[model samples]
Target: MGIKSALSRPLAAYVVHRDRQWQREPVAAQLRLLRRLAATGAPTAFGRAHDLGALRTPADLARLVPVRDYEGLKPYFDRTQAGEADVLWPGRPLYLAKTSGTTSGTKYIPITRASIGNHINGARDALLHYVHATGRSRFLDGKLMFLSGSPVLEQHHGLATGRLSGIANHHVPAYLRRNQLPSYAANIIEDWEAKLDRIVEETLPEDLTLISGIPPWVQMYFDKLLQLTGRPIKDIFPNLNLFVYGGVNFAPYRAKLFESIGRPIDSIELFPASEGFLAFQDEPGNPGLLLLLNSGIFFEFVPAERFFEANPPRLTIADVELDRQYAVVLTSNAGLWGYSLGDTVRFVGLAPPRVVVTGRLKHFLSAFGEHVIGEEVEGALREAMTQFPAVEVVELTVAPRVSADPGQPSRHEWLVEFARPPADAAAFAGALDGALRRRNTYYDDLRRGNILVPLLLTPLPAGAFQRHMKRLGKLGGQNKVPRLSNDRALAEGLVENP
Candidate 1:
């Protein structure tokens, strides 16, 4: 056996136990998680106020703590940030992860020691799952380039605060850190453009086996590497066998990323957020990510269609039905109590409980009463891209455009920046529109009614969104272009860029 495989036996063993229990008694696992949380967090003000100590069942816990968003929990989070002890978790957070959003601005998410450990353990379990499925550990002996944010964190009242990737980078095991790409000095560069430049310089010659990052940013790196080496990534890094990605749907970039790499390699999808490590893709063939029921995060699901309703019903893992969309509400060891992560997901597997992240709850275009989600839009775009074999969509976003004149009907406006421009941009947009109409009945009805005008497609100049993000100081890390927006500000801003 390989040394890495031998050392990972315990983790592999835990995966076996966890997967068996997940398949057999997922509900029991969730109950045990809640009970454990009640014990650990019982002393905190949030726990005491919610009567978490006395809670003996999931139903009891749910009834006591109302589902809350970041704004709802901001007060307690503020106190915790101000050095208060046990305001939410057992004590003060080990660090704060700054999660940036267009609507909510920046949110400081607490990360306790236990929560950080769970994040690390989740990453380990992801690899262990891969090893178990494929019986391959040769990649373990080679280097891993984590194309993440700057690791040098800023101090906030004696507590480190930075991006989630940066926070996790601080806790990366020394053994793996030895193989992680980009020198410490290169990684600490705050400017993403500068960091990418330095990363290319430092790791271009390394024998990298694994690469992990958000898809768009990694695409940028791949493009840049191709520009520098005049060779495909597979040729440059011959041993590069695995690609781990998250923070956006990989569908649109699948073809483009493959083209840049010049070949297919193993890929894993992770559904991690600053709030918690939620799920990760377990099966190579299956696109669905397996929810981590025992990973220090208690989950509740509120149907996405009814999320805005007053007192929307929150269902636990045991009650979630397959193929139904739900907004994820999580109570984690990270001090977030009954917090809604704002991401929507649909369960594909009930036995072991697997889910596919659909979209963000707030990030939908429903101006004309035809609600179009990120998943639907992305899927439509992917289908359309299949027709234009030569074109590659680099970045895109959509917003509603209500006519200024009274007689005009409203329509959807798409701003797309392509790496390889389509021969016929109008034809491409038409295909995308037709695909959306087929996928969303509401959208199709509105179009057929002439209440909404034909979808308008505007080809944005390359790097437009990247430039906008850079201006917003959100050019990299977990920050991504919001796929769908109600307001035209973000899309228009990118369009307005000369």
Candidate 2:
């Protein structure tokens, strides 16, 4: 065995053991972390303004600081960007993770020195947990490709600013540096298509074992590799075994990804954001991710249904109930107070605080009073894919289409990009529509009442989603097409009629 593989087993055991200490006492750990964050933020401008020093409990936090999204907190973020020390956190952030925002345009989220470890350790612990569970760490000896943003940072008012993935690239552990692939030059290529070509050239001859990225981009990489080598990914990289992915649900892409590889492989899901590394899949075959309670962040759950209410109840770890959907609010060491992460989650396990991300709070379909979430659409698509084994989807998005003509009925339109088009397209649509109706009572009611006709399925031309993303200048690097939108904006841009 290689030295790294041999050492990994003991390290995995130690990491898992250390993890369980907090896992077993989630509420206590979270409470302690919350108190610590409050105490740490006590001296900051935001802390003083929000009375952070007086916060003794989650209720105090909720009452004192209203939950704010990026726009709400932009002033504080701007102050930090202007090089104001201790405005939000203890000092100017170590780096600003620049991310695309809808309303706010470019967002610079603070990543403080103290909180950066959470991001790094969360990823490390995920791998260690896999190693601990499977006792198969040989992949560490081979080249590991992390398909990520350019690691190039630009100065933004004295703070080093870059994409979160790019910022993360700088912090990859020294031990894994030798095994990391595609080189720094390939990573910094600004144009994604050009970058993919460079990456393929660099890694094609190497012994690549593990590949990690957001799903769609990974799929794009797999496609490129197959195109270049004219071989299934399994044949190309015989040692390739694990896929680490985050940012989207993998179910819709699983069949296509495995088909591209010519075999099934182990995969890990992570719940990470600019704000914090919230959770990771701790066990194989479990859909729920274990929420990191002691990761320099304190979490609050507000019922997603009542999230827009002026005074929604913010429940802490001890108060959250299993199976209920909640909007995640957080107070972190980076000095975000009562910040809404915008993602909705459902708790599946209370003991270790395992959660499944349902969808974005703002990224749902409610155009016709039928509130269908990301989970429902993904579940429906997964069910349809299972039933139609031959149908392999590349990408898909849904949007509600309201007919201007009174005689015509309004309907949800699904624009699907297929790797292998279903032999019976109508049947596939029926299966998808049925699955959705089964999951959502409002959708079922609308269907039965004929207020909305059966969903319209539009088979998009090959690379339709990619073309649209390219047009929008979001073709790669942590960008993803929303599963469903309330209006026809994304759908209209994605494809022409028929």
Candidate 3:
């Protein structure tokens, strides 16, 4: 075996330091991390309530609170919706980081003092770790454009308003508050059409070298940038580095975005989320996901079988074996005790556990009684896209709907934006159609004969993606584009006309 990665262990140790000393402690010695978080204020109250039940081993947390989903937090949510002071966070409640679920309701996850501390530490830790792993300090090379939720803050307009992008930024650490191109309050709730226009006109820095946010939204930004410059984006920001993104899957758009900028996925990095900055693509050569501050939050792994069942055994950090898909659960300084963020992960190893996010247990297409997951969809899309040479997919989304025809079948539909515009839409559509049917059984039957039509290829306007960013008010900076929509309302609204 190779001796060691030059920068990984030291970077891992730094990440561990952020989690109140628990993150760095060995898996077998994190009881101290638990005790430290529990002794603090605000967290101490809720932590006591969860009891977190003696985390001597991964199996121990199972004895405390079982893995929980948002549906399980109805009481806390109700308290929050009612403006109860003691709803989620026990202290003065530093702030709220609002994230939306697949369905309608907004989840105002409490970001306490510890959570804020961890967020800042992790954000910086990720930077430091990236440098260590790559021996590069491109962090300040170019301004990072974040395509995110609205930056505007509206007071009590409605509960769902909490999911706006601007409100979520409230919890971002003070240190990072300035590097942003525009204040998030400018993105949140407003006339998106106008905000995007101003954002497009004002922000697009000449020195921009890095772009961050979700894939779809960044694609939109590239579209807008092209409209403004009338030249290749690669020509505009010649030094643009990587696209740091999260919130949804990125495989589908990898081809499209790269074709636009004439680059590849290595220029981008995926991230960890609310549960913790769980893992990141550390070293390009390694092709492995690096676990962050492992000692900070104790990790537990339950076989896929136990994810939805009543009594799943929680495997400790030391107990995790490589290459196994597990339902993720965590105990952290953020005051989340034995909380199941409702996501799945795959481990590449045990010690320091290199891992990759697999899929979200909650977000899947169950409308057809067929359980299709994020990974399956990503796999099929990549497999289909591989059919063409020099083709990059800019926009790809899946939806479930019944057509108006008498014998119509339930189907998966996609809208692809390509770098080299296809000469024949019908031929291009047919090739992708044949590939999907062959790759997936349920889908194959859906397209057998007259059931579901082959996948539809929508040719976007020259600056089509930009119109989307302008519409969403994510002209520049860590904003994201919507990846999958079951309903066509939003997609139709986003459709481009040349």
Candidate 4:
């Protein structure tokens, strides 16, 4: 490895900074820079802490900044592109990643050269980490599949495409070109059904050693693969060894990947963003995830318990504790400083602080003021399914509905699927609901008060995830499934049948 000083820019600085941070858990110099950045980010948030110049210790980083979601930074982004003083960090960035945000619209996330470097390098490093973990030198055999959205967007002001941050996997690196399944091969975001046809038609080959993307997208590919071919996955991709996934939890979709594929492979979970690739599943057999601390960004965590508190402790890389769930935050050199991304994570064990994704800090249901998260629901579903390990919970989404009565509160209605379902539905749903209530007291109270009735379970129409995937134009990737849905359209459509 050699230094490309000519490529020195935001990305270079970020990679360098990340390496330094890893060698030593954030040093005093880095802490000072962080304090100044946090102070600026704080006022941008809800807090009023200012004028404290000399931030000497890690404790200062722990001081609470008024919680600010991505919405708070929109103004800064607008000003930056306008050639005005970019209020957020202070730079004219390179390009932006078009991400589907929490507010139900496409979010154009700014990315500097640094952000781009982090994403590419982080992904490469993550792949390499997987290789090391599995003790394999070469990726099993054939092409690498990417299940992502149409990356062809408006041409970037500087050069080629504005979709680089999200779709760069399809381009940028020459190494990826030899074996690539650009899911959006039609040169457009075609209709969902047509798109899946393209995906299915291209992926039928058996040379692929690894398949990667969002879990839903991966599941979608398999559904089409199974339906069109009518063969077990082993018959399709006999050489497949890794089912690399990210963007959401894998526990719920675990059975689908392992059972439907009907073969053995690594169902790995990773934490990546438009900002950068970030963390990945590091330990083998354990399958527990760890941050490539030296990847390309700095990391931070806000104490999970402070989730609703007026003030919460922020954990610097130095202060982060193992085994405790916390809110994830980052400060990549892409001009994003001390940015809180609103994802929840927990340390799996100490030693090197192996972490497991707890859940999304945002993206939860609290209709009756009870915070019901993805992790809680998935845990309950997985535990209940363990009673019948032979079956898997393919695609299950929950919606919070309040009953139409004076004192009634909200309840959860679930839509679930199984490859070959078990004989009993009533017992499974009951057991799942019980596990949920036991884990979350708010859920128990809701049921007790009739605020929420016991969980309603609906066996979806055959191939629901696949149907949604086809409708959504999902291709091959870890991104196939519609992970969370608030409305009951998918569930209700099934109720009339099962």
Name the best candidate (by lDDT): 2
User: Which residues of candidate 3, in runs, are more than 4 Å off?
Assistant: 1-26, 29-32, 35-56, 80-90, 102-104, 138-142, 150-179, 183-189, 262-268, 272-276, 285-287, 294-296, 366-370, 400-411, 415-498
> Residue 151 lDDT in model 4?
65
Tens-digit lDDT track of model 4 for 207-265: 77677776766776777888888998877877777777777777777777777689668
Models 1 onward score TM values of: 0.96, 0.99, 0.75, 0.80
Candidate 1 residue spans exceeding 4 A from truth: 5-14, 102-104, 404-408
- Judged by TM-score, which candidate is best? 2
- As a whole number from 0 to 100, the lDDT of residue 374 in candidate 2 is 95
Residue 68, candidate 2: Cα error in Å is 0.7
Per-residue lDDT over 157-187 for candidate 3, one digit per residue giving the tens place of the 0 to 100 score:
2333343234445555554455565445456
Instruction: Report the lDDT of model 2 for residue 317.
Output: 88
Q: Ranking by lDDT, best first?
A: 2, 1, 4, 3
lDDT of each candidate versus the true structure: 0.86, 0.92, 0.58, 0.62
Error of 1 at 322 (Å): 1.3
Residue lDDT tens for model 2, 1-498: 799999999999999999899988888898888889888898999989989999988778888899999999999998998878999889789999999887988988999999999999999999999999998899999999999999999999998999999999999989899999879999999999999999999988999999999999999999999888799999999999999999999998999899999999999999999999999999999999999988898999999999999888999989999988899998898878889999999999988889999999989999999999999999999899899888899999999988878798899999899999999999999999999999999999999998999999999988888888998899888998899898788888876532
Candidate 2 TM-score, C-alpha based? 0.99
Q: Output the worst ten-in-a-row residue range by lDDT, candidate 4.
A: 1-10
Can you write out model 1's per-residue Cα lDDT over 1-498, one digit (the tens) per residue? 556657766667678667776668889889888889888888889888988889888788778988888989888987887878989988788988887754567888889988997787777778888877877767877788898888778888778999888888877777777777877899899889999999999888798989999899999899889989899999999989898998899988888898999998899999989888899888887988989888889899999999889888889987899988899999888988889899999899987899999999989999888889999999899888888888888889999998868687688998888889889888998999999999899999999988887799988887888889999888977788889988888977887773
Candidate ordering by TM-score (highest first): 2, 1, 4, 3
